[model samples]
Target chain A: MADQLTDDQLADLFAGLRADTVAAVLPPGADAARHTVRRRRQARAAVTGGLAVAAVAGVVGVAVAGTPAAPPAEPTGPLPTADRSALRDLAESVLPPDARSAAAWSFSLGDETSNTAGELPAGSYRMVVACAGDGGTDVLVRWTPRGEDNLFDPERAVVVATGETACAAAPSPATLRFVTPRDGEVMVSVEAVDGAAGRAGFAYRIVPAR
Target chain B: MALTTDLHPPPETTRAVPDFDELYAAHYADLTVQLFAYFGDRQEAQDVVQEAFCRALARWSSVSRYDDPVAWVRRVAWNLAVSRWRRARTALGFLRRQRVAEPQVDGPSPERVALVRALATLPGVQRRAMVLHYLADLTVAEIAQREGVAEGTVKSWLHRGRAALAVQLRPTGTEVSRG
Candidate 1:
């Protein structure tokens, strides 16, 4: 019969278990790893830039648009519910031909509390924003269609831009003319004039300009 | 106001800052492996580690200056993994209740699967203590400090964890001998 296992034996057993962990997944080479790091850095910058844009725009919008733009009326449409993968596809579908995603976050709006000032009334929308700080040249912003309701109503589904500079082109419902300001960030605000219950929100990121 | 400083300014010692490239090269694989063992899922491990590294790179100038940069990354990665686990559990639980088939997660060795299954039987605290102790090879005091617990408590946990693991790992012949 075997005697009680010693601490050394126990440690050896644990070490053996570690050995059984199979081959460690090799990293995607040093160059790929470095690229990942850079991409991540840019994504962080984009998020920070988005926040900065929102802060600056909040101040500018009050000074420029006046009256907090009166939060859009909550929509009364039949909101669409989508899994994260569907939302991601929606975000990707609207990107400019050359744009690539860097990061993404999903959110729910029309709830009791407001997560962002740039929300639509009560329908689900995904905000896909990207940066051009690294080497790229434009930030892409897309909102998933809130579905049949007042989600796409021109007056209700309005997009507003506020910051150092206004949208380069005439502002459309979703155009902040991110291509206009070469350096500074701008907030791209969306709102549904009318709203209903159960709205979803998503944030998708794209690689910043190199 | 009187001048408070003399002519000498603080010395400029250029600390070696490992840029994103260097840092990723040095730590990514090891971190992924450690986290894989921590969570028993390779994809989740990789995702969380990548997210943590991204956060580190975002704050590189400051994060790189930490006493233990790897520890900073590991801590963030572990926290991210735990948060992901909580969210997935809730979401997947709902799916399970509705009879929906959840997505499959691949890439765990048979031994790893067994180990995780065995570890799951222990209390969460004991499981954490054992993994950090045996897998990470952290000393009792280090575990205590990391866990915000007393060293005596850590020792007790380690003792109990070892006893539980021994029973779980006992050879099949041992059961027959007792029988």
Candidate 2:
């Protein structure tokens, strides 16, 4: 049956299906969507801001009593800075104590790949990638020996290692360990594997392997 | 003053960000349609897509800078649809035992209904592969990357899904002989 039907025929069928579905459903207007989002953001900020203030007050009270106060969690403030710091901390937490940072990058990861590269001497290293977002997209991490120029050329460069980590509020870092054959430039790239379009605050670091 | 302003003109970095309203208006209906085909519920599909847009709006400052910001909204919407469908499936199972009658809505064309039903028969991975390939117009390599599977795996899923749909939708007397 499949041999009898052409690719165009199947595509037409699916296209028709989409058209029919669209006719049956009416999506909300952009203004409505924006209003709802703004309201939700305000509500969430109110709740989280209240909690953060209470937590800080508790820590200050403890210090006033002359108790040996533990270090307080990072205060939440602006969205971009807070997310960057949180993702950086998450990426750093996965590194070994003796690991020295070679290169680090922070970016808003979408469907397109994000890359960061640096020169390194001959040594074993660990690459850690972390992402945080509202969606369930997973970030794929690929390490290649050549610069970005040859990153896509299979003949010119071979991918050393690959791993993936989910994008979440509390993300599990993806780590890859590989040894450089010779001292040269190396590139690491990250992209969302899931087809859905969403954005995440992503941070990655390269450190000496213990 | 005019010469100095022309020389500097402030930074154009913010120009890279896309307009949220335009993006939302352009993609809302199409994304809802895709989600509707994935799960056989139009209202749920619209709701999930709306929720995804809402999430994107909350983080527009960063999301708008992405190379393909619409892709982010699409992914988030699909993720929401998948999770919601899972929860609905569980509740539906219990409701079936109680013989609950579902609310009636305007129906789709018979052919569309048949295609969706055939798609529903497929495994989740195969269905997703079919939808992404056929509807989303993604290449085999793109589908493989999205699914975290090899190209061969994605090809196999698409082949099997097409075969299953053909078997289900083929007419009783239709047959073609290979040369």
- DockQ for each model: 0.07, 0.20
Which lDDT tens digits does candidate 1 get at residues B10-121? 2224677656677777677667756765566666777888777765554444455555667767776886676556546656656533432333344444545555656667
- TM-score of model 2, chain A? 0.48
DockQ of candidate 2 is 0.20
Candidate 1 per-residue lDDT, tens place, A1-210, comes to 253445666676657556644345655544654466565334433332232232211211211221111222222432455532343244334334434433233232222211222222322222333221111112213222334222222222222222211111111112122221222222232211112113323233323333
Model 2 residue B105 lDDT score? 51
Report the number of clashing residue pairs per model. Answer: 20, 7
Q: Where does candidate 2 stray beyond 4 Å?
A: A1-5, A49-210, B1-15, B94-105, B172-179
- Candidate lDDT (C-alpha), each: 0.45, 0.58
Candidate 1: chain B TM-score equals 0.74
Which ranges of candidate 1 are over 4 A from the true structure?
A1-6, A29-210, B1-23, B93-109, B176-179
Identify the CAPRI category of the predicted complex in candidate 1: incorrect
Fraction of native Cα contacts reproduced by each candidate: 0.13, 0.36
TM, every model: 0.49, 0.55
Residue A86 accuracy (lDDT) in model 1 = 45
Instruction: In angstroms, give how far residue A22 of model 2 lies from its true place.
Output: 1.8
